[model samples]
Target: MKGLILKDLITLKSYGKSLLLIFALFLFLGLSSGSPLSGAMMVMPISIMAAYVTFSYDKLSNWDCYACTMPMKRSEIVIARYFVTIILSLLFFAASLLSYLFTAVIMQNFSEVYLLIPSYSVLFGLIMILISLILVLNYKFGPDKARIALILIFILPSIFTALITQSNVPMPVISESTIMLFCTIMPILGIAALLLSYLMAAKIYQHKEF
Candidate 1:
């Protein structure tokens, strides 16, 4: 499993230039916006993109077929992919946190960091849920179809946001207690979703033919 994860990481290293460019771009946006949260928002998409890049590479190389010939179980392969996703999520989350801190310092708003902790935690949870969905879709449908589905999934939020902005409907006022409850529950739900996704992916991979 470790070897499988290492393989994915080494493969991803070849795309270091592109990733650095993206990082710089987001960092600049964060700095320019002067909002640490804005910079941190880049965490989810980038991490998801990294995960999909691995899937694309695997599909291009027919990696599953080759991997099946090795001694490891299929479940291990699925688990390793999850591990890679989780690892990438953490790495990007940490990077975003650092970016947040840097932006805060530049803006002389370091005190807001404490206030933003809950938001950051919520973002982390959302990232996990998104990654879990990506894993399950990739394992069940292959990367090509999964890409289309995920694109729609990504677009729904924007479409909803646009509609909400144009509508006369009033937004509900959420209390701090409710917000706290949501922030606390989101991570727990995210964890549940990830474990469920793992089970589904393992089952799919077990019966999957290369």
Candidate 2:
């Protein structure tokens, strides 16, 4: 498992420059706008894209074929990919949080920073669900349809967010306890989705001919 993860990190080396540049741009945009959710917006896509990039790299390198010839279990490989996605997503979230904090310091207002906790809950859950969905589709359809799968992954989120944004319904004012409870519940659901995704992917890969 560790070796598989190490291989992904190495594969990501070539993509580092592009990811960094984009991350920097998003960080700048978030800071300039003084919006933590904007910072989170930067984090979510990039984190999901990182997983896609790794899978693309593996396909291009014929790593899957080679991996089957090795001693590792297919389930382990599937789990490793999920682990890599989680690690990269968490790292992106940390980076986004820091950027928000830096902006808060400059503006001398920390209230917005506290709001990030619940906002992050939503963002993180959404990303987990989307990432897992992408991975499962990729496993079922294979790399040949990966581009289409990626598009499908982004479409639902875009439409949902758009509807929420365009709606005339005013935002609700929830008490702190309610917000905290929501934050706790959401991440648990996200984890369940992630685990279920892993199981489904593992089953699919185990039966796949590679």
RMSD in angstroms between candidate 1 and the native structure over all alpha carbons: 1.6
Off by over 4 Å in 1: 15-22
Error of 1 at 32 (Å): 2.1
lDDT of each: 0.83, 0.79
What pairs collide in candidate 2? Answer: none
State the TM-score for model 1.
0.94
Model 1 agreement with the true structure over 1-119: per-residue lDDT tens digits: 88998998888886454555656666787878877668768877888777777899999999999999999899999899889888877777777777777777777866566657798
For model 2, the stretches where C-alpha displacement exceeds 4 angstroms are: 15-23, 160-179
Compared with the true structure, what per-residue lDDT tens digits does model 2 show for residues 81-172? 88888887877777777767666666676766667778888788878888888888888887668768777677977898889899966888
Steric clash pairs (candidate 1): none
Number of the top lDDT candidate:
1
